[model samples]
Target: MASVADNLTMALRKQIGAKLNVLLLRFFDQNKSGEILSRVTNDLDKITETLQTGLLKLLVAIGTIVGSLAVMFYYDVLLTIIFLVFMAICIIITRMLAGKNLKYAAFRQETLGTLTGIVEEYYTGRNVIKAYNHEKESMEQVCANTELNRKATQKADFLTNSVNPLIRLITRLSQAVIAVIAGTSMLKGTMSVGVVQAFFQYVNQTAEPLTQASYMINTIQSALASAERTFELLDSEEEIADTKTPVVLNRAKGTISFEHVSFGYDSSKLLMKDISFTVKPGQKIAVVGSTGAGKTTLINLLMRFYEVNSGKILVDGISSVDMTRQGLRQNFGMVLQDTWLFGGTIAENIAYGKPDATREEIVAAAKAAKVDYFIRTMPQGYDTMLDNEGGNLSVGQRQLLTIARVFLCNPPILILDEATSSVDTRTEKEINKAMQELMNGRTSFVIAHRLSTIRDADIILFMENGNIIEQGNHQELLIGNCETGLQA
Candidate 1:
């Protein structure tokens, strides 16, 4: 039974993980990592515990209770009736306690999830917390959450543990009353001494099973609360399904058009309304705007990470919706402001997008990104193993490594989302030259705050409040600056 339970739990955990992997990005935005983690680990463990022991014990207790009742009824009907009256009272009380137990158990699980989210948030931002000297504040927040969890756990445990003793008390009282009535019958010569003894033995059997059943039922109720949480996660919204027959784009010419595009994270509140833009193949498009001006959102729409609320995004004259997300995304390469690296060798990290890349191809790409010299300085060079998130490397190095990944991919369309923001000025200039060569024929979208980096772009787009307010070549925008007071 234990082995079977383990296998079942393993399958459940795997299903939960697979569901999370396919859930829409909005789900992640709304939930905390630690809360999700708690559901996957702690809640699943509760279910497993119930399956391994509580379920088995409850089944046995039920069987014993039924069998014992049959023998008692056969011995004496009057005494059986007396015993059942007290058992009914016990059942009513246990039922009441079980309901309360489930409620408190759910509350306890919720508080635990909150506490986990708090701890995970603080831990991930520990460096910022310390830099700002907010250690005391962080600790206080954790303690407050912990106290909530403690109180909830106390209430749940009180309800769960109290049920056993309460039911036992009621059963013992029933046993005492039955014993008194049986004694009177024995004295009146209506019952044999041996029959009275046997009835008392049966009473003991039934009473013990009743106590055990009450306790196990409460435990099972608590586990059910956990199962509820796990199922909730498994039932979250997932990404839109792929097309039945998707347009396969092995290679794209990189002509993109946004035809009256309108979108918002929330469908009811449109952020970008009636926005339209077009990019010819091999053209350089620079997107510039203040923070929250929908620059990144535009990129997200183009990549189909979040679908547009209303509009058609066309790539190479075909509606992107007609293409599989993977097929559509395959033609574009993106390097974001934030860099991500895993625990692996430097070469492995660079080859992540194309796992079967040769070492020579990896080295050539690194050199083009101006990170080859730095990689060689490491003790094991490209073979050096990086810790989680590449903690051993400087921020600039990490950014360069990501850039190298994009360089190797060499997609027809490139998105550089403040990709060079982390490097020094000299390195930025060098990367700009390399990027210029990279963009010579491929369509590129450059999102940058620095005006100097995009002065030579083929066309510049200035966005505000999710709309493109101005767009022209660098010189045209400058020439119109006096009229519109536009500043790039």
Candidate 2:
């Protein structure tokens, strides 16, 4: 019975953990990954540990205490009453400790989460810290978090450990009292030797279970603390659900338009206000701006990574909000400044956008991205396995792989966000040639840090302070700027 109950508890814990894992991606997208990892791993482990042993011990203790008490009464009613009074006192003492155990357990779990966050951050950014010669500062931060975790764990463990010894002391005292009562009754000729022996045995049995029961109280409090943290994450608000009867974007010609758009990460301050733009099918549009000029914010809105405060972003002629998110995103291909390559074969990375792509299809895309020659130089060619962080590949090589992924996808609309910025001048020229070929007949949006790259664009939107201050072909914007030495 204990084993079955324990298995059920474990299964329940796993199911809840799995649900929390999925919800974390959608609900806590802005939250740190380390905090989520701590809740799923450390917090869930505490609940499992208690359920596996503490629960079974608790149940056995209850049964033993009742059975022992009944046998004692059958042997001698007066002796049983004497033990009961002492047992009641022990119960009161254990009750007084409940709140403190809870407080410490919760504090310990919280500190563990903070410690995990520090360790994760330090490890992920170790290279950056060393590059900036801030290794000493990073180590100091790690030590600070470690010290806090140590103190909290010590307090929680001390409280839990203190319970067992106190319970044992009370049990010994109760047994001593019971022994005297049994001795007196046996000498008075009212009790036989056998009954006295049995009575003594029952007293010990009762005390042992009561001691275990007291310790179980502490186990339960600790488990509840961890469970509460897990539940808090599970209950966090999820992303906005798709509208009822959402429009499915079956196919689109890629004409894009943004009408009177307004948005801000914080509601009190507007970042992009009343923004409007249009790009006809097959047109090449370039958006150039200084840092913090809301250039990326515009792209995020187009991809629906964020919703606009007040505006309509249309793909084809349909409002983005009307379409299901998945259906809407299917029409676009994106290559961002940060190239993401997972631990897999080079071929797999290129086929990420089309998982079932044929080998020939993958090879063709690589060639178009101007990376085939490089891949051939590798000993394993397409089969070469990438390191977890792509440590084996150069920055330009990683970007080329990402571009190949988009080529195989072949969506009607394309977004290149500083796509060639990470490469050297030579590689940038080759990548730009490949990109131009890919963007030939697609409605494309280019967010460029290099003005030279977008000089030939059909339209250039030069923005400042979240508004387009100038919009025209490159020559038109440059006509007066050359004379004044100031941007139009």
**CA RMSD of each candidate after superposition:** 1.8, 3.3
lDDT of 2 at 73: 91
TM of each candidate vs. truth:
0.95, 0.88
lDDT of 1 by residue, 114-184 (tens): 99999999999999999999999999999999999999999999888998889999999998899899999
Model 2 per-residue lDDT at 152: 87
Ten consecutive residues with minimal summed lDDT in candidate 2?
479-488
Model 2 ranges with Cα > 4 A deviation: 1-30, 70-85, 180-199, 469-472, 475-488
Candidate 2 local distance difference test against the native: 0.84
Q: Candidate 1's error at 15, in angstroms?
A: 1.8
Best by TM-score: 1
lDDT of 2 by residue, 135-247 (tens): 99988988998898899889888878888889889889888887887788789988899998988988988888898998898878888898889888767754466678888
